[model samples]
Target: MAHRFYVVSFGSLGTPDVVWAPVTDTAFQLDFEESLWCPKALINDVLTANRLRLRVASRHGWAWADGYGRAGVSTVRDRTPEETDLPARLIEGGARDGA
Candidate 1:
């Protein structure tokens, strides 16, 4: 199957930003920390290994580890309703209308 360059942007888990390049783009590199580009095949390897759920965030897309994760997904108890509520001070304190 054909692969293309991918923007490996920041995930919430602190994965490094990179440009996953095709062999045609440059010689293959295994050292990720020293460079911003790596062979695109590396991405396929990682995604397969991690078994993450991937999805497009919007038309201009990004990936997350798991689409179904919500607050407290890993915890035994859900967060308190008060903990989840948006602070009234934030809303009242010079916040923009649409924001």
Candidate 2:
């Protein structure tokens, strides 16, 4: 059986929380309360494509969702960006001011 996937992002004032589950599952019988199901191949692709980006974001205290075959709650630190190699233009104006 093919596994479905979900990408849940915790809510914030600016961005609402979201659960990216399979829409085609009309029965909604998937057990996702404790864990999401992301396929192994896709997870590998994502990790390979975003390895550098993920590493840099980690340095800025950003958090990520659990990967394929993993189960856990996501977390992030609330703090101002002290420094970053990422361009300032990429960040929003408010974030630039330590918002």
Candidate 3:
């Protein structure tokens, strides 16, 4: 069976900010201290929506490690509830009304 995995980069708030790459090799060794594993499916939704290019960059970011022997999926939050509420706040403040 072919297994798939994702390497993700997270922001300071522990939200996944970027997807580094995907590997099918379950035995692939990662720089364990610096990175973590996530399931390919979990990241696929975001990857498809944003059309993000998957590639590893710098060394500091959060990662999701599913408990399964194979990589697992986790809930990915692109922004905090407060962050997502900004537009609503702006609209309520009349910013959208050209105030």
Candidate 4:
């Protein structure tokens, strides 16, 4: 079996570039606090963990603990609708049409 680096992230490194070596490629994206967790030393062969749902405070809309989760698979914790900003197609336009 083989693995590929589709979306590289470096949370433990605190820098996304640290994961991408050779210092190549100009086109890229960078996010400081708003970025997602980057894998450090752990490597899942088939990928076991995935964000299933999000938790939010009942009093406010602050981001709750983004604890480990699985989409429609595991029930590690209760999920609130506000906790996930899971990207969805607002308008299902063709990719060629800049969707």
Provide the RMSD of all predictions against the true structure, rounded to 1 decimal: 18.3, 14.2, 16.2, 17.5
lDDT string for model 4 (49-91, tens) is: 2232232222211221222221111111332222223111101
lDDT of all predictions, in order shown? 0.24, 0.26, 0.28, 0.22
Off by over 4 Å in 4: 1-42, 50-54, 67-99
TM-score leaderboard ranking: 3, 1, 4, 2
Counting clashing residue pairs in each candidate, in order, gives 0, 0, 0, 1
TM-score of each: 0.18, 0.18, 0.24, 0.18
How does candidate 4 score on lDDT? 0.22
Show the colliding residue pairs in model 4: 11-38
Ten residues in sequence with the least summed lDDT for candidate 2: 47-56
**lDDT winner, 1 or 4:** 1
Which of candidates 2 and 3 is the stronger one according to lDDT?
3
So what's the TM-score on candidate 4? 0.18
State the local distance difference test value for candidate 3: 0.28
lDDT of model 4, residue 73:
11
Residue clash pairs of candidate 1: none
Task: List the candidates ranked by lDDT, beginning with the highest.
Answer: 3, 2, 1, 4
Which candidate number has the best TM-score? Answer: 3
Residues 1-99, candidate 1: write the lDDT tens digits.
222222222233222332232232122222221132222435665322222233222222222222122111111123221222221221223222222
Q: Candidate 2 at residue 96, lDDT?
A: 19
Candidate with top lDDT is 3
Residue 79 CA displacement from its true place in model 3, Å: 24
